[model samples]
Target chain A: MTSSTSSSPPSSSSSHSPSPSFPPKSHTPATTAAGFIKAIESGSKHLLIKRFTLRYPEQKLKFVGDGYQFDPKRAVGIAGLRGRHILYHDKCTGCQLCAITCEGIAEAIGMVRVDEQWKHNKKAIMPQIDYGKCVFCGLCVDACPFYALFMTNDYELASFTKEHLIYTPAQLAIKPKYSGDVEIKIDDHGASHHG
Target chain B: MADLEDRISESQKMGMQIVKESDDDRLMTLSVGPQHPGSGHFRFIVKLDGDYIVHCDPDPGYVHRGEEKMTEYRNFIQNIPHLERPVIHDSTNITYSYSLAVEELTGIEVPRRGQFIRAIASELNRQVYTLYWLAIYGIFLGHSTMFMWPTGDRELFIDLLEALTGARVTHAFNIPGGVRNDVPDGFKDRCLRQITYYEKRLKEYEDIFYNNPLVRQRTEGVGILTKEDAIRLGVTGSVLRASGVPYDIRKAEPYDVYNEIDFKVQYMKTADSFARAYVPFLDMRESCHILRQLLDKMPEAGEVRAKLQANPRGPPGEAYRRVESGRGALGYYIISDGTPKPYRVKISVGSFRNMLALPHLLVGAKMGDMPVIYWALNYWPVEADR
Candidate 1:
C-alpha cells in the first residue's frame, strides 16, 4: 500500500495529506534571494570562529588510560590504540599463543629463542614483532592467555631502516616513553586542541 | 583503440553518410575515474553529447582484493580486520552484520550491554562516515568551506571512537560474538557532550550548504530518480529513502538495539540530487537521537563479549545478516562447514547496489551535474568493489 502511493507522481498522490508536495513548492526569486543571503550570513559567521586544526608533531593529542590490555581470566580486552606491543617477560610462558594468532592475521609475530632463561618461560623463547607487517588489530594481545601482552600509547615508531621495524623480545619488553597532553577543548569561541 | 578504428573504417567503407568528421562525432566518450579528482578509486565511461551525458557505464573494481576469497584463507575471527577494511570509516556496522551472522551460527548469546554498546559504536561510526562523504561531496561541488567544517567537526566522533574502540577508522572492534572491549570511563558523558555540540554544528551545515541557492540550483531537479525507478533499480539507503520509499534497514530490520531506539526514517519525496544529499543530513540528525536513546537505555554492567573457545567453529550451516551502515544496508552471508574458516562468504554492499542507479540516472543528466549526481548517491568506491 505504501509502495503504491510512493510510486505514483506527487501530483497524483494528493489523497495522502501528509505526503510533502513534490516539486517542493517551486523556488521563487524572493525565496532564492533569501537563501543566498542566509548562505552568505552563515559563511561570514564562521570568519570569527576559532580554527579547529590540531598542529601535529608540535601539539600531540593526549590519550586516555595507559593503553589496551587484556584479562585472560575474564576473557575481555581493554580498549586503546593498538600501538606497539608490550611483552611481560615474567608472564609470557613461551606458549606462542600471540605468534600463532598473528600467523593467520598479519604474520607479524615470530616466536624467537631468547638466551635469557626465565623460570616461567620453559622454552626460553618470546615473540618478536615486525611492526611493518602489523596492522595493529590487537588480536595478538587478546591471544595471550597469561595477561602477558598489551598495547601502549607510543605510536610514533618511525625508523630509518627496515631492520629497525622488527622489534625483538628484548625491545618489545621495554615500555615506550610517550607524553602527549593536548586534547579537544570546546568553549564558546569554538573547539580547539588544548595542550 | 584498434577496434574503434576498425569499426569506423568499416562504417566508412559501407558508404554510410557521415555529416561531420570523426573528431566531431556528436558523442564524446570520457573516463571519469581511477585518476579523476571527483571519482575516487573507481572509473566510469560517460558519453557526452554537447553539454549532456548521453550514456554512462560505471566501471568499479579498481580496489578489489577478492575480499570474499581472502576470507576462505582466514578463520572467522581473523576476517574481522580485513572485512572492515572495505568501509573502514564505517567499520563497526560492516563488522556488526558479520558478528550477528556468526553469533547466529555459533550460538553465542551477546549480553544486553554489549548490544547497546555495539549499537552506539555503529551510530558513532555512521556519523563519522557520513561526515567524510559530505566533506568529499562538498569539495566535489567547489564548496571548500563545506569540506573543512565537517572534516574538522568529525574529530569529535573520532576522539569518541578512539576512546571507545582503540583505532580511529579501522576499528576492528566488533568481533563475531560481540564487541572486543567495553566503553572506557566517562565515555557516555563525553559522547553526549560531543553529540550535543555536533548537533549545533549540523544547523550551520544546513545554513551554508543545503540552503545555499547555488547548491540547490545545481542539484534540485537534476538526475531525478522517481520512486518506481529507484525501487526498480534496487538502490538502497538514503538514495532509496530520498525517492520516498522511507525504507531504513535499521527501522525495517531492527538489528541489535535498533528496535529499542525510537527514531523516524528520514526521507524525501522529490528523489532528485538535492533530495539524495539532504536525506543523509536528516539521517545524521536522526542518528543523534538514536545515539542518545541507546546511551540512556544501555545497561550499566554486563559482559561486552561472549566467551568463545580458542578457535570457535560453528555447525555446518549458513547465516545471513545485515545492518544499516553509512552507505546503506550492508549484508554478509557466511557458509561455515563446521570449521573455523568459512567455506564461502559473500558481502552485499549498498554502494554496489546504488551503482545500478548511476547509469540509470546519469544517462540524461548534464555533464556539469555528473559530480553532483554521483556523489549524492553516497557511493564509496572501495566498498562497492569489495
Candidate 2:
C-alpha cells in the first residue's frame, strides 16, 4: 500500500565513460594470454550438455527401488475420506431434497417409483443417479431424506458407449458391478432396509 | 471544436456538470475488476492521487452460488463430493476437510490406509497446482517455453491420477472415514514412473525457467510482502512462508499422514513475487520427495475404508475443520440438526482469502506489471468466486 522511490544522480555521456577502444598503457601480453585461457576453460562450450528428457510413450520412465505400493484393505487412519453411496429406499418418504440441492447443472440424478406388484403392497419409489450427468457434486447424495443414496469411490464408469453411463436400480445396487470388477462391499450385510 | 461544444451542451442539458478541481484536491477513483483479466472474478475500487494508492475497497459475491443455503436441502453422506467443485484443483484437501468435520461430529475414526491415500492424493494435487502456477508465471513473463514445459509435464502426473482414481479433476475420492477405493493394480508402477519423469524434468525447468535471468528480473523485488504485513493480512501457505514466517498448516496442525512423512516446509526470506514463485518450485521438489517416501512406506495390500458403527443417524451438533490446500488453508464449517441433511455448510476457500490482499499488493505497481503480479499470486478464479 505504501510506495517509495529512489533516484541516483544521472551519469555523463557514454563517450566520456571508460572507453575500451583505447589501449591500456600498462597492459601486459602474458597477463592477457592467461586471462583468455581462464575464460575458455570456464566457458559452457567445453562442458558436456545433457539430453536427459524422455521420449514418452515410446520410452517410458522406470522408477528406482521397490515396485508399486497400494494401500492396505480396511486401513483407516485419523483422517480418511472415501466414497459411499447409500440407498434409503424405504425411508425416502418421497421427498426430493436431493434433486433441489443438485444445482441442476447436469440433471444427473432423479427419483422414481415402481408400480406395486401385489394386491395390498404400496408402490416402491427410489432415487437413481445417471452417472452421465452426475458431476459427482454429492449434493444429491446429501439431499436424501432417508440417507439412501451416497457416492462411492468406485468411479470407473467408463464404457465404449454413452448408453452404459445411465445407471439404473440394478446398476446402482449396493454391490454394483463396475468395469468388470466386483465392487468392494463395505460389509457382508445386505442393503439396509429402513421403513 | 463544434463537436466538443455540442457534447458540453448535451451534458449541461442532461444535468451533468463538470467541476474544475486541482490535481492534489481531487481523488481519482479507479475500478479494478469483475471482468478485468488481472483481477479474478471479484472487483476492487481504489482511490488514488498521482501513483500513490489511498483507500481500497474490494467487492465480492459475484460467483456465490448460495452453496450454504443449498446445503440445507442436501443429506449428510451426499454432500461430501458436492463441496469439492469450488476448489477442484485441491479436490482431496477440500473433500478431506469436509470429511473431517463430519467425522468429528459423528465420532468416526478413519483407517490408516485411507489416511495414506489422502496424503498421496493431496501431494499429487499440490504438485499439479504448482505446475499450473509455474506455467502461468511463464506466460506472464512472455516465456512460452516455461509455460509449455510444466503443463506438458503436468499431463504425466494427471495421467497417473487418472489411472488411480479413474477420473481427472473431480475424483471425489474421499468419504467421511476413508478413501473411496484402493489403488488399482499397476498404479504403484505408474506413479513411480511419473515421479522419475518429474524429477528429471524439474532440473530442466530449473535451467530454463527458475534460473532464467529475465524471470528473475521481473519477479525478484516486485510486490514484496513483509512478515508483519503478511501476518496482519492473515496470509498463509507459501505466501507466508516466503516472508520467513515458516508457518504451514501441515506443520502447525498435522492432519492426515503428514506427521508420519519426512518432508520440510520450504521457505524463502525475500518475500517478493520472485520468492513466492520460488517457493512453489521448491514445493514441487518437496512433493516429489513426499511421493517417493509415500511409495516406499505405503502398505502392500489392505482395505481403504474404515468400518463405521452401523449406519448412524445425523448428529445434532456442528463442527469446523481446516486443512492445507494447494493455495493455502481451506476450511469447511458444517452444522447437522439430527436430520439426514445438514442445516448449514460453509467453506472458506484459500484462493478467496489469498486474493483479498491483491489491492494492497497491486497498487503503485505499473499497469504493465499487473499480469506478472497476478500470476505470481496463483489465485484460482473458481475457488475465489465460490
Candidate 3:
C-alpha cells in the first residue's frame, strides 16, 4: 500500500527529524515565479471553456420517465423527481394510506371528499396536498398500496398565497405541463447544459 | 470625578485594562460568532495577542435541531428525511450508518446488489460533500477560481444522484432493509461518463489550488497537530489521516461491500493545515476509484430493498453502526425497546471528534491562519451540533 509523507517544507529542523510512524521526507517548495506562472496558466486555460450555468426558468433538466411511480405488486418505487403528488382517480380506493403515512412526516396530505364517482373510490375522498407543509419526502408515494399516489416531475410549486399552495384532489389529478429537456453535455471545450 | 475613579479601579481589578493607558494589555478577546461567514453557524471565543491566538473556546450548536430527541417521535422509516439533514451534501453516508444500525436492530439482511448500490451512492455522496467543502476551503483561502471549479464539477455527481435517488441532496434512499430504488436505466453509462470527466478535473484542482505557492505558504506549516496529540485528542477522518493515523472506518471496519472493493486509505504524514486540506483531495480521488470498483462489481439484477411491514418494529436491543463519510467516520447508535420508534438515537459524527483538536491546533497559531486552520479540519458545524 502506497502512503504519502510530508509534501510541504518543514517549519523547523526538529520537526524534520525521523519518526517510525511515518517516513521522513519533505519536498522543497517550488520557486515563487514558477508557482505563480502555473497558477496563471491553470486559470487562463478555463477562458476558452464554455460557461456551465443552466438558465433556469428557461432551461430545465430532463427526467428519465413521466414521474416517480410505485408498483404495489413489485413493492418498489421507480426512480424520478420527488415533486408534486399525482393521484389516479380510477386507481385510488380512498384507503387514506397516503394521508396516514404523511401524518407522521409532513402532515401535508388530507383526504377531501370529491364529487366525481369512481368504482374503486366508493367514499369519494382523495388526498389534497398543501405544498407549504410538504417536505417532499415521497413516503406518501411509498405508502399507497393501489398505484393511486405518485410524485410528478413538476416541482414549480411556488404560490402567491398560502391558500393557493394547497392542491385540491382535482388539481392534484390534473397532470402538470412541464417540458424541460436540457441536459449536461460534456465536450472538449467544457461541460454545459444543452438540449 | 470620584465615581469615575472608583469605576476605573473596579474595572482594573476585574482584569479590564484601559485602552490608552495599558500598553502591556495588548491581548484582545474576539468573538468569531455566528455572524462571521468563515464560522458557518458556529461561534468561538478566541483570545488573540497581536497576530497570534492565545486561547480558543469553540461554541457549537447554532443550528441544533435536537436530531437525537426528534428520532424518538418518528418511526424508523419516517426519520429518514430529517436525519439526513445534518450533512445533506453527504446525506447518503449519514443515512447509510443509520440504516445499518436499524438493519441490525430489525434483523434484516440487505441483498448483494443492494449493498453494491449503497456503496456506490455513499462514494458519490463523499465526492459531493468533499467538493462542497473544497469549494468553501478555496473561497476561505481567497482563491475564487478554486471555488468555481469544484462547485461546477459537483453538479455532475448531483445530477447523477438526482437520477438515482429522485432528490439531489436529501436522497432518503437508504432505508433500514436496503435502498429505496434500483439504479435507473442508463445510470451506469451516465455515471461512468461523468466520473471519467471528473477524474480529469481533479488535476486542475492540484494546479490552481494545492500547488499554488500562496496557498502553500499560508497553510503548509500553520496549525500543526502532531500524531500523538491527534490520537490523544480523539480526532477521526481526514484530520486523523492528515496526522498520519491512516485509520479510515471503511478500511478498518469494511462495512457492506467495502471489504470486497480494493482501495487504500489516503493519508499524509505532515499534520499541518496543508496535509489536512490535501488529504480530502486524496480521499476524493480514492472515492472515485471505489465508485469505479463498486459499479464494476455490482451484480446484474436483484432486489434492491427488502419489503418490510408498514411499521417495522425492532426487537429490544441496541445497535451502533459507523460509516466512512466525506468528513470522517459517521456513526449512529440506536436503542430499540421492541417498538416502531427508537428509544434513544445518538449520532457520533467525525466533525465533532475532529473539532476536539481545534482548540489544540488554533492555540499558538496566527490569527491570520484561522480560516486555513479551521476549514482544513473538515469540521461541519451543523453536523457537530447535531
Q: Pick by TM-score: which candidate is best?
A: 1
lDDT of 1 by residue, A59-142 (tens): 887887778888665688877776788998888899998888888888999999999888888899999999999999999888
Q: lDDT at B355 for candidate 1?
A: 88
RMSD of each: 4.6, 13.6, 6.0
* Model 2: CA > 4 A from native: A1-107, A111-132, A136-195, B1-30, B46-56, B309-315
Show where candidate 3 strays beyond 4 Å.
A1-30, B1-25
In model 1, the runs with Cα more than 4 Å from the true position are A1-26, B1-24
Ranking by TM-score: 1, 3, 2
User: Taking the tens digit of each residue's C-alpha lDDT, what string does model 3 give over B1-386?
Assistant: 99998998998797454454544577787889687788998988888999999888888889998999999999999999889889899999999999999999998999889999988998899999999999999999999998888998998889999999899788889998888888899998888888888888888788778878888888888898988787777788898888877677776667988878777767788889999999899889888888888899999898988879999887799999999888887889999999899999999999898888888989999898899999999989999999
Worst ten-residue run, lDDT, model 2 chain B? Answer: B15-24
Model 3 chain B is weakest, by summed lDDT over 10 consecutive residues, at B15-24
Q: What DockQ would you assign to candidate 2?
A: 0.05
- B219: Cα error in model 3, Å: 0.6
| Number of clashes found in candidate 3 | 0
| TM-score of chain B, candidates 1 onward in order | 0.94, 0.88, 0.94
Q: Summing lDDT over every window of 10 consecutive residues in candidate 3 chain A, give the lowest-scoring window.
A: A1-10
Give residue A191's lDDT in candidate 2 (0 to 100). 13
